[model samples]
Target chain A: MSVLVFSSLLFAASVAAGLLGAMTGLGGGVVIVPVLALLFKVDIRYAIGASLVSVIATSSGAAIAYVREGLSNIRVGMFLEVATTLGAVLGAYLAAKISGHWIAIIFGVVLLYSAISSFRSNVDHLVPIQPGTLASKLELTGRYTTADGTHAYSAERVPFGFGLMFGAGTLSGLLGIGSGAVKVLAMDQVMRLPFKVSTTTSNFMIGVTAAASAGIYLSRGYIDPTIALSVMLGVLCGSLLGTRVLVKARVSMLKQVFALVVVVLGIEMIYSGITGRI
Target chain B: MRRPSDHELELSVAGMLRFGVTAAAVVSIFGGLLYLRQPHASITRFQKFNAGGPGLRTISGIWHGMVHLDPRSMIQFGLVLLIATPVARVVFCVIGFARQKDRLYVLVSSIVLLVLLYSLGHGFQ
Candidate 1:
């Protein structure tokens, strides 16, 4: 294909990925990597670099909105970032040393896990746990305004949450995906933050985690400007547009469809990695 | 003076993030289009993926490229701005916490900032 045509196609694919990703709350990086690496025959490194850019774009975009809405907890977000950022640096360093095939295989597994987890609803609010001494001292407790009214919640299991965030950051750096799912798992399940707080806080942290490695990727020459330019712009546009549809659109069906797509892509990635095709 | 609450701090961070992402997006779009208009190697530059271009590997490199209107370097410059946005947020948080008299959080945010800068400065090598 001609350069223009190829670039256009990639741009369009990224837009679709971003759209689905936004509506599903998965973020766009997961789709961009598999499509670029498996379908377009781009090398995994370039694909990852490009995908990470999109992750940062989508996360920052949505995070701005969440922050404005008062859904995200700033204190919790900042405290957890210390762990995630450190983990991101470590993961990025490991990515530079690991073989491409292994990265692909690991990405496939992560993708499949996210796909299965995507089917579960994030709308359910959990019982707020009592804040630990560390959490109380750090002032991680906060209230978020919902349609029902302002609800107060406290953070628990600070040490466990911090440890999990480290793992989330590592996965994000290694795979170039947002690792939002893992971040949510840490905050929602382990930390016992409310659903809204957990999701929004996860959104807030993703950009920083991705940024930690984005510089590393740039220095490694994995972030091809041409590819990252198209991917980031397309994903940004798509995610913005998707946000408009999110309020009115029925997303359960769409989530099912997108989850299936992720499963297929995951299997393909794993198969290709094993066969040395990617 | 009453220190600003976390709520107010979040609003400031939100505004900063919005502005940063929007600015980065515009610059990226301009650079991407310029890149498309020029005669380039290929849609996918796998070979060049691992080869660092001097124009995008450092801060000075980006400045020099922007001065010369190099599309790739311009795009890299925008990306640097995007990545730096969150780092900037972390910086903002450190100051916010310090001003709020939250000594512990100020220390936490500063540690995060140091880690981020260290990786940006040396991780690739």
Candidate 2:
């Protein structure tokens, strides 16, 4: 296939990936990596490089809407970024040492984990509690709007949340995923922020975390503009369109279907990685 | 310094993000088309990782490439802009916090900014 034909195919696949990712809230980068590495036969490094660019595009694009809606907490997002950005830099440093095979295996495992977790619905009943000393000192408490009204919440377990963010950032840099699953886990589970706050705040931080590593990747010559350009454009277009469809469509059922697809893809990736087919 | 209200800050942040993504996408799409317009000697190898030439590996090289209207360099510049968007957000927040006399957050935002600058500086080395 010629370069033009190949780029067209990639653009189509990324559009689908972005749509499903936005509809299901799983993120386009997760779907992008497996499809590129498995179906398109792209090198893992290049696939990762391309997917990271899309992750930034979709994330920043969606985050604009989220911030404008007053869903994302800028203070919390900024505070937590110090941890995530550091972790991203460290993770990028490590990626150069690890071979592509290990990356594939790790990516497969992370996909399966994300698939299983997506099977469970998000817990919405956040028990309000006073934030810990560190959180209180940093003034991380904030309010978010819900259907009921403006709800106030405070962060807890600041160290734990920060630590989780480090891990999230590392995985993002290593696997070229947005690592939204881990970011949400840190904010929603460990930090004790409300679900809305956690989701939007995670979205707010994703671009910054990806950027930290993206700079490193660019310097290392992993990012190919030709591949990255198609991906960035495709995912941005898809996610924007997905947001429009979201209001009209019930996405619960779509999430389950997409979750199953994720599992199947994860298994294939693992199998391929073990067999050296990738 | 006159402190911007939270509402104003939020608007600025959103505006920055929106502009960054749109500008990057437009530039990337243009570069992509320019790239596709060129003939390929072989099917572009998707399976092998190609470390592109020095045109994008260093800041000086990217600047030179931009002057020459290189498609790859333009795409790289777009990507750089995308990365810088968040960094710009952090800078704005620092200014906002400092203006508000919120010393703690100004300190926190400063640390994030420093980390970003450090990584970028290292990237150039």
Candidate 3:
């Protein structure tokens, strides 16, 4: 295939990845990366670099709407970013050291994990709790609006959540994924934030974490400008369109289908990794 | 002197993010089109792993080439901008926090910004 054909095909795939990602809340990087590596025959490093760059674009773009809706907690997002950003830098540094096979396997494992988590998604029930002293000191408590009324929430385990954020950031940088599931796990399960608050706050931090990785990726020359441009633009456009359709569209079914697709992709990634085909 | 309210601060942060992503996307799309128009746009050589050329490596190099309307450099600049979006958000938050006399958050935000800036430093030289 020629560069034009490759770019056009990659862009189309990225659009579908982004759209499906937004609808299912799994994220574009997960789908796009495997497609790039497995199908497009792109090197794993460049595939991830492109995926990481697009992660920032879509996350940042979507975050605006989340912030404007007052669903995202800026205080929580900013505070936790300290850990995530540092982890991202560390992950990016490690990405350069690791071989392509290892990267592919790790990404595959993460994909499977995300698929399983999505299968059991939205199980968290919000229970009001007194935030830890550290959380209270940082004023990491707030309320979010629902159709009925506003519901108040607070962070429970500030330190644990911070640690988990570090892991999330590491996965993001390592695999060039948004790692939203991990972020949600930290915030919703461990930190005891409201579900809406957790998801939006994770969204809020995704870009920053990805940016940290993307910066390192770009400097390392992992980011190819042509591929990154196509992926970024496609994902951005697709996610934006996804958000619009999300309100009126039925997604529970879509989520299940997408999860199954992710499972197949996950297995493929691992197979490719083990066979040294990627 | 009045401080910006929380909602207002969030709005400012959102505005910064929106602007950064939009600007980055616009610049990237233009550059990508230019790139596609090149005669060699039909060649596909991504099958192997190469770190790429120095012309597209450093921040300064990308800027130097971008001035000459180098298509690849323009795309790199846009990617740089996209990477910088979250950094800009952190910076905006720092200002927002400082204005609110929220020293703790200002400190926290600054730390995040520092990490982002440090990562960016990798692209400098």
Candidate 4:
């Protein structure tokens, strides 16, 4: 296809990906990679680079709200970033060494996992775990305003949470995704943060984590300006629009539908990877 | 002077991020338009893996291209800005942590910053 037609189509696909991502809280990177590689026939590397850019766009666009809501723990976010950024560098380095097929296979598995997890309702438990010694020393405890009142929570299992964050960052760098599911798992389940805190903090950290590898991608020639331009702009616009509609809409059903879409895409990616079609 | 509360610090970071993302988006759109205006824009240049042009591989190259109105470089410059936004946030946090008289978090933030700068400076080349 000509550049105009191709860009237009890619932009539209990215918009849809962003819209679904915003409504489902999955972020746009997951869908964009599969769409670019499977439908547009773009090379996996370029697709990854482009998808990572859009992830940053959507994350930063949503940051203002998350920060204003007073849920995201900046101290917690900053501390864990050490692990994530380090892992991001490692993942970017490994990307060059690994084959595209293996990357696709791994991405498919992660996609399936995230989609399945999204189906489970997050029941926020108030039974606070005791903060670790490191967490206490570092002051990694805080309270957030709930509808009823302010609720306090503390960080637990700091080392384990940091390790999980490193794995999340590695997956993010490897697949060009936000890896929000893994991040939430680390913060909410492992670290014992509140649900709102976990999700918003995960959102808060994604941009920095993704940015760690983006520069590497840029220098290494994975980034295609034309592709990234369309993808980032389209996703940014779509997610920005999606957030406005979100307040009025019920999203539980929407989440399930998007999860199903993710499943299909995950299967498609794995099939193509196994068949060497990508 | 009193330390900045978490709420105030978050507000500042939020404002900074909003501005950065907006500026990046505007620059990217401008670059995209210029790119589409070129005669050669009809041809797609991304089918295979190539190391990209000199104009986009380095920060100085991007600056030189922007001076010459090169579309790809302009778009890449915008992307570089986007990448830097998060790094900037980390910097902001470091300062915030310091202002709180929290030496441990300042150290933590600095380590994260160093890793980020290292990645951006060069891949494991």
Candidate 5:
């Protein structure tokens, strides 16, 4: 296909991926990477490079609205960041030395895990406990009103949450997904935050985590501006539209459909990696 | 009932505008560049850069130069803009929050500001 035609298709695909990603909370990078690497036959490195930028865009675009809505737990996000940023730096260093194929395999596995987790779970509507700690004592924990009602949440197991963030950050740097699946898990499971608060807060933190690795990728020549720009633009536009639609859409069904898509994509990624076709 | 001070409202609005502009600018600039370039260029660049052989060194050199190209150095100038713009917004928000003594806003904006600085510093190398 001609370059013009190909780019147009990519643009459309990225927009669709972005919308689906934001609505489902799976993240745009997870979708973009497979589409670029496998379907479009782009190099995994460039695809990753592009995916990182989209991750940043997704976070930045989503964060502003989430924060304004008073849904994001800023204190929780900040406390966990110390661990995630550290891990991100380490992961970026490792990524520079690793082969693209291995990165693809890891990304594939993570996606599969995210798909399974999403499919198997239901959103927990638990009330939040008050935060305790020098950080929490500062009144970092708070309540947010979801569509259901006002749900209060809290941060617990501070140390464990931070540790998990470190691992999530590493994966984000390594594979460019912002590790939202893991971040949400850390907050919801380890910290015992309500799902709405955890998800929004996780979104708030993703931009910074992505920026950390994006910088490393940029310096190492992994990020190509042309590709990064395309992905970012598409994601930004799609996310805006998605956010609007999310308010009106039936979320459970959307999540189910998206989870199924992720599972299929994940299987394809793994197959490609093992076959050396990625 | 006490009304919100004009200065406070102005500050809040300014903070919101800063964020909106930054997000829009980044997306527009990057997206426009992508739209302008040929997909064939993207494909060719990807292949050439990834191809392993004696030409690998040459390809790396070219890719490195492209990344560091003048007027558009991805890491040097692009990164500076990316990091600086958001940080400036956070700082402005911090100042506004402090003026109002809104502890929550101050806390949140401060955390975001610090994270942005840390990400910029730790990211490039």
Candidate 6:
């Protein structure tokens, strides 16, 4: 295909991914990277580089809205950031040494795991557990209102969550995806935050995580200006539109659909990675 | 009832400008280095500078140094400063609104400004 045609297709695919991602609480990075690598024949490194930029764009775009709406737990995000940012830096450094195939395989496995987890899980509406020690001292717990009503939540297991965030950050840097699935898992399972709070707070935290590695990637020459700029701009616009749709979206159905889609993509990635085609 | 002095406003504006300028400067400086070292084949060169590849290094060096930072770090920083100016304006507005004990306007305006800023920063750019 001509470069213009190829770019346009990528742009449309990114927008679709952003739309699905926003609606279902998944990050666009997961969907974009594999598609670029497998279908478009883009190099995994370049795809990853572009994915990281889009992650930043989506998170920054979504964060502003979530924060202002008082849905995001800013303190939770801030506390967790220490872990994710450090992990991202380490991950970016590690990514330089790792093979593209290994990275692709890992990404595929994680995507599959997240899809299954999404399908099996239930959205808990319980009040979140309070933060202990320094976390509590920092005033990290807060409440947010959903369509149903106002629900208060708290954060716990600060050390564990932070540690997990570091791992998530590493994966994010390595795979060029937002690592939101891992962040949500850390916040929801380890920290025991409610789904809403965990998801929103994860969204709030992704930008910083992405930014840390983005600098590394930029210096490493992975980021293509045209590709990065186009994907970022496209995802940002799509996400803004998606956020509006999110307010009115039937999230349960969206989650199921998203999970199914991710499973397919994950399988495709695995196949391509093993075949040495991606 | 007291108000923030003009000096306070100046200080706040200056602080925002400083931060924006600093971030842009850092990006530009690294961007320049990436541009300068694009032709080299050394992995250490790529590692030290953090260039992803030759193409990225070339582009960032050109884009950031010329379009984004040509005038100076201060100029690039000014763009950030400009982006944040409304935030400072709104904080003062809210403070003034609060002083009048008209809490409603402050709440409404704060949310409005937050949404506006969020959209502008995230959407068009």
DockQ of 6: 0.08
**Candidate 3 chain A minimal-lDDT segment of 10 residues:** A123-132
Distance from true location, Cα of B76 in model 1, Å? 1.2
Native contacts recovered, in order, as a fraction for each? 0.71, 0.74, 0.87, 0.82, 0.12, 0.08
**Native contacts retained by model 6, as a fraction?**
0.08
The list of candidate 4 runs beyond 4 A from truth reads: A127-132, B41-44, B123-125
TM-score of chain A of 3: 0.96
Question: Which has the higher DockQ value, candidate number 2 or candidate number 5?
Answer: 2
Q: Give the least accurate 10-residue stretch of model 6 chain A, judged by summed lDDT.
A: A60-69
* CAPRI tier of model 6: incorrect
Per DockQ, what order, best first?
A: 3, 4, 2, 1, 5, 6
A1-278: candidate 3 lDDT, tens digit per residue: 77888889888999999999988888877888899989888888888899999888988888767877778888999988888988998899899898888888898899999988876646544556464577778888887778888777778878999999999999889989889989999998898888778889888888889988887888778899988888888998899899888899999999999999999999999899899998
Task: Output the TM-score of candidate 2.
Answer: 0.96
Best by DockQ: 3
Better structure of 2 and 6 per DockQ: 2
TM-score attained by model 1? 0.95
| Clash list (residue pairs), candidate 5 | A128-A152, A128-A153
1 or 5: which has the higher DockQ? 1
lDDT of candidate 3? 0.86
Model 5 scores a C-alpha lDDT of 0.67
**Which digits, one per residue and each the tens of the lDDT, describe model 4 over residues B9-79?**
88898889889998988897898899888766433456567786666877888888899999888998898
Candidate 2, residues B1-125, lDDT tens digits: the string is 57787668878877888888788777766766677677766644667877777788777787788778787788888887787888888888998898889999999999988888877775576
Give all TM-scores, in the order shown. Answer: 0.95, 0.96, 0.96, 0.96, 0.78, 0.70
**Tens digit of lDDT per residue, candidate 1, span A1-278?**
67778778888999999999889887778889999988888888889999998888888777667877778888898899988988888888899898888898898898898898776655545445454577777888887777898777788878999999999999988888889989988998788888888888888899989988888887877788877887888898898889889999999899988999999999988998899887
Q: Candidate 4, residues A1-278: lDDT per residue as tens digits?
A: 77878889999998888888888888778889998888888888999999999888888878998887888988899888888888888888889999888898998999999998787678784535355577777778888777799777789888999999999999888888899999999988888788888999999999999999998888888888889989998998888888887888999898888999999999999998899887
> What is candidate 3's CA lDDT for residue A100?
87
Each prediction's DockQ against the real complex:
0.65, 0.72, 0.80, 0.75, 0.20, 0.08
The window of 10 residues in a row where model 4 chain B has the poorest summed lDDT is B39-48
Off by over 4 Å in 1: A122-132, A147-149, B123-125
